[model samples]
Target: MTRKPPPDTTPDGHHVVIGGRRWRATDPAIPDDVGARLRVHLMAARRAVGVALRAHDPEAERAARDRVQSAKVALGERGTPWWEQSPEERRTRWQDGLAALDAQGAQGAQDA
Candidate 1:
């Protein structure tokens, strides 16, 4: 027999209980597709940071951390929510973030 996990809801999605402290969960206003894409970037950067640490490469670690920050910002967890912005403004935010990610990839290729 198996038992189901307890509920995690607070007000938004799920309340993350860590060391007896409650924190805001990931931003929910992010569109599904964009959220998934950003998570991919976040995970890749996280892994890269770990690998860089093992390899003792501080420059690569810093770059990977930058990627992690960018992904979080784009996913609406850093600054104001995208939906809260005007239409034109929201579009610009997405474009710039995504373009930066692409540029990071290109830079990685050049470095390799």
Candidate 2:
């Protein structure tokens, strides 16, 4: 299988271009470890959304989507534009986001 190339970024690097569409890019300032964890949560939440949809569970789908939003916002791909935020704000955003996602994972494990 061939892997797709990385998306092209705008000159300013705040957004990526894919299929002639623009999407916010993840914050460059995020540490590698934190970013990886956030991506894990994002993918898991996405999978959960699909599972919920297949089961016809609206409540579960909503919850999964909420997780997706949280992960995106934490990664600086959503909410306030990362470039517009101060350094401290950027750090806090990712740190808090990781904490929240971690807690959610723990809670889910316990429930299961």
- Each model's Cα RMSD: 4.2, 1.2
**Which tens-of-lDDT digit does each residue in 1-112 have in candidate 1?**
9996743646545344555676445555556776687788789899999999999999989989999889767765567655467766655665577678878877888988
Give the TM-score (vs. native) of candidate 1.
0.68
Quote the positional error of residue 51 for candidate 2 in Å: 0.3
Error of 1 at 92 (Å): 3.7
Worst 10 residues of 2 by lDDT: 4-13
11 in model 1: Cα distance from truth in Å? Answer: 2.1
Superposed Cα deviation of residue 19, candidate 2 (Å): 1.1
lDDT comparing candidate 2 with the true structure: 0.99
The lDDT for every candidate, in the order shown, is 0.72, 0.99
Model 2 Cα lDDT, one tens digit per residue, 1-112? 9999999999999999999999999999999999999999999999999999999999999999999999999999999999999999999999999999999999999999
Best by TM-score: 2
Candidate 1 clash pair list: none
Clashes per candidate, residues 3 or more apart or on different chains = 0, 0
Best by lDDT: 2
